[model samples]
Target: MISVEGVAIDTRHWIGGRRVASDRTFADISPIDESFLGDIAAGTAAEVDAAVAAAREAFPAWAALSAPERGAILRRVADGIDERREDLARVETRDNGSLLRSHRRGVMPRVAMNFRFFADYAEKLAHPDMEIRGHRERVTYDPAGVTAIITPWNAPLMLATWRIGPALAAGNTVVLKPPEWAPLTASLLADIAHEAGLPAGVFNVVQGIGAEAGAALSKHPGINRLSFTGSVPTAGVIAAAAAPTIVPLSFELGGKSPLLVFDDCDLDLAVDLAVEQFDNAGQVCLGAFRILVQESIAAEFQARVVEKARGLVQGDPRDEKTDVSALVSRAHLDRVSGFVDRALADGARAILGGAAPEKGLYYPPTILADAKPGSEILTEEVFGPVLTFQTFADEDEGVRMANDTRFGLAATLVTGSPEKAERVSARLNAGTVWVNCFFVRDLGAPFGGNGKSGIGREGGTYSFDFYCDVKNTVFSPNGWKESSHG
Candidate 1:
């Protein structure tokens, strides 16, 4: 166990505004140096049941509060997160092997911002009322009872807050299941929520592996809605489990997104965007895996991309200078490495990195040249610092190759021509399209995918709609007059 302020920190399930211990615990290790961070409670089916029951009990009261009242509590939660920004960021860095620089400047701030945005947005939420043919019609948005929020390990706290903030703002009670690999930050979030004056049972955290706790939460009958962000295979299981209950589910799954580089594009900016495949060690779901360069300048773009990728510094995540860090775990590192090996065996040439380091769970940033369109390396989501290069003859072919993947979470197109950007953006099969930039997110815009990437949207007004149930009511006045038609 880890200690804080001379006291051992207990890692347990947070239920009903209190910490609840379990029969067993699992150790959390940092991938950066293989240091044992702490232990998290091994929650089970029974624990999931208890948490859901508590949320069900708290639903009526929480949903009864005014929208502004809920918004105030949510705003306080955001402030609390901001106040402990350093501690939260450090914990996340240690837990997930994300670079400290990313945690500080990117992930942590977004975590707080998600809460604040939802807080302010909740007040502006409204259900319109109109008179149709002299009859009164009203629309109402109600909480979707208990919500099950399952988050991935890559960005645990930030992703959890993405669903939790909107769900709470929409007056829904949440039962959050943080990835067992990085449960510390989420456990702390439970405390933060309570400290922010959120009512008991409104938000709960249960920690365990996906098979036990996650399955239990998904299969629970009391859950009215499910929001999951993870791999496609796991999402399939969750959807199957939730099917028996006929609950509404929102999924944000894997992606094999593509980045298109036109001959007219700025080579420097295109190179930088291509290097984003190495960002977060390429664990990002929206990271571009396939680089489709126009045939006219494919060779030049490939050379620049390989050089830039090789220049990225890889070392300890805690070091401020390190541009790339270790993968989340040794197993994941091996998985990513295996993909690279398979690609080389299939005649794909490595332009840069192609092997893991001798010591830690670090796979060097890799770039594969001559990768075929249907090759496993190009189609599958390696979720590592691996980039595959492919060429397209024309605009039509470039767009076609970009949309070839089964997953379509996001796509990026680099072009100097405004006409080409507008034309290509409309044809891309993705939830979000970046014309010249990559991973530029706006909190107010919809953020989800099509097909296997995800089922529904989860940002701005879309999040509000997903977390709540809309009901329409119509009434006829005692002396209502019908509209006269010719």
Candidate 2:
């Protein structure tokens, strides 16, 4: 067990605005290697109840805070996060095995910005057009009682805030479940929120695995809604787990996002952005994992991409000079390696990296070419720095290829023509289609995908519709179904 200030920080659980524990604990390791990171207490169903109960107890007060008032507190919280920027960045990098430089210069800054973004955005949230309908007066939005945020470890800090920011901004109390793989960052973030003047239980976190704590959170009687970001299988489990309660569940599930580069696109720009898409070891849910390049320039673009990927310096995550680092764990590495083997068997040729480096859980930034459609690698989400590319003949073919996946969370297109870009973007079948950029999120823009990519929109000013319950009112031009008997 690790000790922080001699408080036996090894065994810890976040409950009721503080870190508490029962009797269970597990060791955390730096994703760089098997070195000890720390030990966190594993919360069980009982502990999950504690967090849900806290969020429920705090809901009325949190829901009553004016948008601007909540915004102000969140702004303070964002400021506090910036104050401890380096510390938080270090913890994230150490715990998750992502590039330290990126974590500090990229992830941490984005996290802080997300907080600030939502704080400012919440104040601007206005109701939809409340117009009269046949036998009905109008419609409106209201905060759901308690919200649960189930975040993955790949980018825990950023996503936790992404899920919690808007919910809290609109006055819904939150209980978050940080990925068991990287619980400390969320624990620390919760601590910062507490210090930022958030009321006790307004924003609570509990530590445990998906089966125990997560199932309990999804099935909790008091939690009004569930916002989850992870793989598709887990989403299915959440759906089944929430079945008995029939509570609303929001999912941001697996994505095999594609980047289609037409012949007109500047090759350099496309390659650079594609690298960024798969950076930090390509563990992001929204990373542009597939590249569908026009055949006219596929050969040259492929070579350039392979050159750039090969240049990625793989080493200790703590080194400031490193471009990429290790995968999150040995099990994850094994899974990715297994996928690489499958891809190889199916005739996908690897141009850069395919195996986990002998040293750490590092998978070299790999580029695969000639990958057949519906190949396991192409069809499934490979959350690694590995990128798969296939060539197409025409604009219509490119768009069709981009939209050929069951997953459609996001897509990117690089073309010079205003007309062509719009036409392709329109038919790409993705929730977010970017013309010249990738992975950019406007906090107020609704962002949920079609198909198996999950349901309900998040971000923008519209997500409250998913997080809130509606009551239809009709009584001599104004009445209510939820109101007391007339």
Candidate number with greatest TM-score:
1
Count of residue pairs whose backbone atoms collide, per candidate: 0, 7
Error of 1 at 61 (Å): 1.0
Work out how many backbone clashes candidate 1 has: 0
Write model 1 residue lDDT over 49-141, tens digit each, in one string: 999999999999999999999998988999999998888888888888998898889888999998889878888877678998888898877
lDDT of each: 0.90, 0.82
Where model 2 places Cα greater than 4 Å from the true spot, the runs are: 1-11, 128-139, 470-486
Tens digit of per-residue lDDT, candidate 2, span 392-459: 99998888889889998899999888999989988989888888887776677888887778887887
Q: Which residue pairs does candidate 2 place in steric collision? A: 353-366, 443-460, 444-460, 445-460, 474-479, 475-478, 475-479
Clashing pairs in 1: none
TM-score of each: 0.96, 0.93
